[model samples]
Target chain A: MQKTTSSISNNISFTRGVPALEALPTTLFSECLQAVLAGPDGKTVLQYGHNGGYVPLKQLLAEQYHVDVDQVLIGNGSLHLQDMLTAQLVQTGDVVFTEQPSYDRAIKTFRRRGAKVIGIPLALDGVDITALEEALARYTPRFMYIVPDFQNPAGVTTSREKRQALAQLAEKHGFYLVEDVPYRTLRYSGKTLPLLRELNPERTITVSSYSKLISPGIRVGYLIGPRDIVKPLIALAEDTTLAPVLPTQAAVLEFHKRGYFERNLESLKQLYAPRLQAMISAIKTYLPGIDFAEPEGGFFVSITLPQESNYQHLLQRAKEQGLLLTDGNGFFADHLNAQANQAHTGDRFVRLPFCALTPQEIEAGMQRLAELVRA
Target chain B: MQKTTSSISNNISFTRGVPALEALPTTLFSECLQAVLAGPDGKTVLQYGHNGGYVPLKQLLAEQYHVDVDQVLIGNGSLHLQDMLTAQLVQTGDVVFTEQPSYDRAIKTFRRRGAKVIGIPLALDGVDITALEEALARYTPRFMYIVPDFQNPAGVTTSREKRQALAQLAEKHGFYLVEDVPYRTLRYSGKTLPLLRELNPERTITVSSYSKLISPGIRVGYLIGPRDIVKPLIALAEDTTLAPVLPTQAAVLEFHKRGYFERNLESLKQLYAPRLQAMISAIKTYLPGIDFAEPEGGFFVSITLPQESNYQHLLQRAKEQGLLLTDGNGFFADHLNAQANQAHTGDRFVRLPFCALTPQEIEAGMQRLAELVRA
Candidate 1:
């Protein structure tokens, strides 16, 4: 029975937001590692590096972002950079703002750092400006975290108009805008919108990572911001991790230098675009009772089940049928707080990640969910 | 004048605790990276990893330490593990105890977390037990941070008897012991002492890293503790960095599997022991008025200047003379707090790391220091 259950659980997984196995450039990465280690600066690469990170990687990122080298701080990963940002800025009783259905882990991190996270309801275009303005008027958040391009869980890209409003509001309110662009380059379709940082560079901090564009195992991520903000983060890195992992950073730099980065990103879009299409088709055919906005890019397609549907029950049944899913309740800050208070909210929502699974697997998984919903 | 100043600053540095460049297994590491990427699990290694860490490395460490695999949690680095631990247990106004001249970065980390840090005085043998006991009598700390083996900035090993006493004290007082062992495996001489974790498995968390043993640039470290503690740390890691860097962890595992870890450690001792000896010899010959406990192993030799010496002036003059010294004041938590309060203490002490410098460089640096002392 246990063996059968284990095998059943291996049937399909839509819970991961990682790149598909076919999308990872394993051989290219190995070559990049070799190229880096055989370079003239191999000895320096192997030694303890500067707290800011590998200088050349910082330089590369600085050039690309049109920022000074000092403005770029390479971290273990962008998530690590977010953790440091919270540590640097948040204190107990502080307020932070995020989209209503935001990335679960970022919400957890903010709350863990003792911030009362206020969620601004998200619209198809972006966060509802009216709701955000009302919250901003009532409380001054230390920072507002926005995943503007292909936002996680919701898969809704903030519109250019929303980005402009956010930039203006941030400037007027005097709160930092933390623009996390981890999925910016993963667009399968849709026109690129201006980044909040590009819109308001002075009050914005942009965080991104190679986890998707490059192999996640490389764990190279960076933050570009004002020099004053980047400086303390570097000091935090020094006291905490000493330095970012250099060999991997060197390998990433080598990969970029070899001009494989753009090509790999193009390949990733090609590989994932079909999977996203498969998910949309499956949802249309098999999940008629579900409501969702079709995403043009990124890994996730979030849906809201029928008002009468019991999502917790559906989730349990889906697991029994070997359809792995990311639970919807975790994506809301207020829902999490309600959970701790022995209440429940947002249980009818679900996020389906399409990048890590094949079209066939996605079809089968959605069919299983359809049967469970009908039953 | 700027170029001359830059050249002088580059002459001799004693501020770093990194391994000598010659000691790094650069070629071996590259081979291991290639080997791991060429292995059957290469695809999985490049994908997002399990939150606990790369599994085989944990298994290897578990077997070596005689603990269950669940008890071990690999981190970005040991300092990162320390950061997680402090975040998990420390609250604002919580008490944390450390050696009077503990690792300066650690003191900064704990203070940054809003812990009211109390420094236990140190003797040549370890933390002064009487001072620790007195502090314990007055307040309960969330945890006591100890670098038992050749403590950083002090180079004093805690005696086995003191380790036992600490274990007992922790059990009686009901506080955790965060036993950091970054320099534990880098011992160039002396008998290996029992780890505090071995003495009291229930209350002690052992944090060690491969930065010194393998290579600092790899940034692999781990913590072994009770399941409850390790579990939360893993969660924190998940919410923060997602997972530790996998390529480097896989390389470390491959390096171990290929049976190179021991030989590399042996080579590291051979490379560093002579440098330690040279520093000790120079201290005795050139700066006779300075008092110090000669360390048998680890990266540093800490010395106390004569009472009449103005260390701030000496540090400035040393910078001008092309001699770099780690300022002593940063090591003391009370001293740091005093500085914020417009007072200063612990300026008489200086920590000189010998591992990154050569015997010749150590000799020259010590001679420069001797000249400064005389002046």
Candidate 2:
């Protein structure tokens, strides 16, 4: 595969899921890191940590998420935790389930493990429950991977009823439910629902990261699940990287201890809300015929062009005009698995991320993209 | 499996492979981090980096190692890179090779990938070349993992002739040579040998880490191989952790740029050489009958106890006296492969790290360990 980039002099990239670069808490992070280096736990912060994680960070995450300390596994990032979970539980050719047009990188990870990934079509509220039940009954998948909170590429959240049903379905079918909730805390316009792990404590593994809330450069994330499920993952973690970066974990703990995490998260919400609104307003003004859902939170807004409009062509043309967006074909499986029929819905769609761009840039980029679509 | 600890009140641990806590360049690290956060690359440092690594950091490493930039792949740590390489190359039930008493964690990573690991006996210079040739002739192993530079748990650096022979054997046998050189830069008294990757660039993959040279808490390491071998590993790195912690990579670059890494290495050698001598002297003064090859450098000095002595008992007794050392059984494979007979060689050995402790503590700990051995 060829590497693709869309930069001409100074491009406006709507393709990154990173937080705003200008608003990153660099000063605060440096202060906290210096404090951690000078603090009583300086030696522990600079040495090789326990295989599971930094204990105090785990304890703090446990309290924040209402789980016992033993249930948490800190890793290099949430993606690392997902790969570890896959390595521990998945055998070659095992069946795995995921939402149609799910996170592209995650689907790649599952497929890399030799899993036959089957995509369940998504409904308005979430993945289609009936389709999920049918797949669970017919395939006996090793697990169902779901992005429950502001699903990637689609920007759709699962309803409370569907979440409950997903838990019950996994229990009934003797399978595990893997919930990825990196955007769970970024709710700008909706009420928060109980986590899938909370609903199905026995059979659910929840993975989340501080990248979206804090900074991606630190690369600290966690997995919370039953003790039995977590034990092997800890061993896998030991074999994977020995341990997560100790100083990063310590810095995160210090950030939380100093009450900067909660306050910075609030500031992040304030910073992004206007950008999201600007993107939505621009879409309405510039592209009247395009179809999209107004995202309540999270970085992405999925746009579907008319059936005859080629998204690949539009993406290339838009790149020429300094507008960078992701073609939705990347978010779907390659039809190498059981759900071959469900892989093609992404042909006319594109994913636009608003978090990394300012309001003015988002408006200009969206207008340029509209011009490309019209041409 | 039960957890093991080497601690008591006033304990001195010779079990840790970490650097001395009191001597870590914390002030330098903090200064470098602050400079990175305040420099022109501050925003980039706090954002998501490229999948292989940060580009500038990769370029620097390539220049230092005399390899093309595309041949370098950085990960969370050296172990992480090893795991990624294993994932890219080995299939379930594939044959792999390692030294008889290898780094235990690396053995675990190989086995976790479902490779049947065979242990080759070690001679005074390094792994036995004749035995390696025999194993290569008998089995088409996927790769041979060797710690040629100050081999962990044994403290024996491979001879230059053996290194050249091993590289040729890999090419002749059509298998890859996986060289782990975490301690290559910490030479106190030995002449530096050419890296295996340099001798056999087409068939050798070299892995190394900055944990030993810098600090483990930063968790930065890299791999150098042919572009074809490294391309899939870069993809695996993407699927494994998205990227290594960006801030750590940037901080590492800044540290190198400021010339702290080379100066710090000289300082570390000065700090460790005397302690290694202290351990050797203490062993000779306290225990007369024990057999060991005096190490030129590196953290460990391995001792072989009498055949009739129960090492487990000695470990327990040593613990009671507030002395901590690693039992050699932890470094051997559990005889699940073709080299079952070679696994038991570790039964009569123990490893004592002289880097993390002071001369005074090393002397006292050795005295207590000698007492346990006699008892």
Candidate 3:
């Protein structure tokens, strides 16, 4: 072949965990760059960024949280902060816990840091408090990781009482609560539960980012917690990307300050709500046996297919037909352990995201899955 | 202390890292957003970005080093990869050797993972090879990190012979060599030796990024090394930022493919060369007692003031006078250790940058420093 400039010099094999990007926010392509262009100095927002989060953006986030300037430490995304907090807080063989089938990315992060993670099952109103009490009583996790707002993988919301109960457990157990709440604002209905941090200032480290609200491409997010915990997280931030992309944060802050967040978020709701409904409809019409919870609001739905079905194989076939879904297995903390895999394994669940796709694409993708499963 | 909707909730104390806007190219930023505005399609570039590195950027980088594509794994940036690669290769008590006064942030990262770092003194020709050899014989670091190009703090390049010798020592000693060459391309005038990766193919990992070439806000960079190593690194990336910002990669790829990089670099030289000269000239005229090796190229100069000098106090004074310089102590991996303090410790060295500042600003900042130091 001719030496086109499109040279992938390295023989880069695929990672098993890359999410399908087809559903990503289309306008993010321009939004991140445009924000940087429009910032006060008209700088590219791409220099050796500040060790702290962007100044105005941090101020913007600071205003939202109603906290002092010292309480927040922004990161590349909530993901980076998640990894950093887990790294700083949990030690090898130390027991840490998260809501069952929660954001698997956080599980992977904590597990990779050598922490033995205990999963508390998710109930309708939040994590099973009874389960959390038992984990606290038995394992005495060093910290408990929670995604209180429309959590990932499970896509469940924790109730106000459950959130308070969890916070109390942290206080009683003397273990920190690591809250990953990137979806805190995407509420479609119901009053939002106060964040674990808001409920108990001393116990919870609340982390959130602009990915869900603005665009993930800019990779701007912040972690809020006690000053002690924030220090190492800041050091971790310094070590990681130094800081989140400045252009994105500057633009995001400007956007939020100018009341653009509401408009953008409204657009997001209009974009995702219909698509989510279409996916729900397709699942209903195509394969009614699949058990899944409808997210109050967020990017994904978790479905438990028939016990006899091989969801992993279906996942492969789905990809073959140009549909992409995150499989349930990789979300487990002990996935790498043969014993844990045997004990905690199930192939009945998969996560489908409709955020980046239009309603039609979601419908069509679900139809293809329906056809494949029937075949 | 208004309960404003604009700020983050917590009274977060930490400062945000600087945004990337102050240093990136503008035209490319707009083009990048245009790509994002285009939706991800079945065959769209956004499906899943390449696992290791972007194809064209990697190829461009690989060709520069004369390495095959199998040798690279791209990630968020050299910073993220540094953490990931260290976490993969390093363990508790593993010895990590860095320059005597090196990138303190990187040093802090390895330490967080419990790596025991031994600093080797830096000289005009790069790391003090003799001292390095002695340290290698003593500690046998899991990896030796060197900025072979315009290094972070010192702005020194290793001699060609030293590069070969260092690579040979890696093979002889059976340890990996990580040549962080971010500033390799940003040269003002001096000759650059062949990168350590080129010196020893099997034992070297070359990490580079567009932070210098284009922008840091895009947060795009790649690591090149053996595929076996590349695999684990990507797995680590799975836990890292998931993937580099997708839109940033697309923007950069478009720019690079359309020959934006070459033109930009050419223009950057024009923008930076005079400033660098102006900085060096000011350093000579004002801070006569403080001496440093003139950087043939790159953004920083490691200037050594007297040990008795109070650099922090000086910095505060400079700031009051509208000038800022990074404290030299942050470059040490063993800042906590009193022994690591022996290597150019305290008010001795300051990393001064002329790349982003104008000739006037450089002159002004240096004049301020001179005044503060003299007082």
Best by DockQ: 1
Backbone clash pairs for candidate 2 read: none
Write one digit per residue (lDDT tens) for candidate 3, span B232-257. Answer: 77777766776455556666777876
In CAPRI terms, model 2 is classed as medium
Candidate 2 stretches with Cα past 4 Å from truth are: A1-10, A289-291, A308-314, A334-344, B1-9, B308-314, B320-322, B334-344
Instruction: Tell me, by TM-score, which candidate is best.
Output: 1
Residue B360 of model 3, lDDT score = 62
iRMSD, all candidates: 1.0, 1.1, 4.2
Stretch of 10 with least lDDT, candidate 2 chain B: B1-10
Residue lDDT tens for model 1, A194-246:
88989999999999999988888878899999988999989888888887799
Candidate closer to the true structure by lDDT (higher is better), 2 or 3: 2
What is the per-residue lDDT of model 1 for residues B1-375, given as tens digits with 9 covering 90 to 100? 012233233579878788888888888899999988888878888888885899999999999888999989998888888888888899989999998789988888888777999888778888889878988989999999999998898889999999999999999999999999988887887789999999999999999999898888888999999999998889878888887789889999999888899999999889999999999998888777566778878898988777555465777888888887777878887865434432224676778999988777787787777777763
Candidate 2 has a TM-score of: 0.92
Q: Cα lDDT for residue A217, model 2? A: 82
Q: Write the per-residue lDDT of candidate 3 for residues A53-82, one digit (tens) a residue.
A: 776666766787887767788766777778
lDDT of each: 0.84, 0.82, 0.69
Among the numbered candidates, top lDDT falls to 1
CA deviation > 4 Å runs, candidate 1: A1-10, A310-312, A336-345, B1-10, B310-312, B336-345
Q: Where does model 1 sit among the CAPRI classes?
A: medium
Give the candidates in order of lDDT, highest first.
Answer: 1, 2, 3
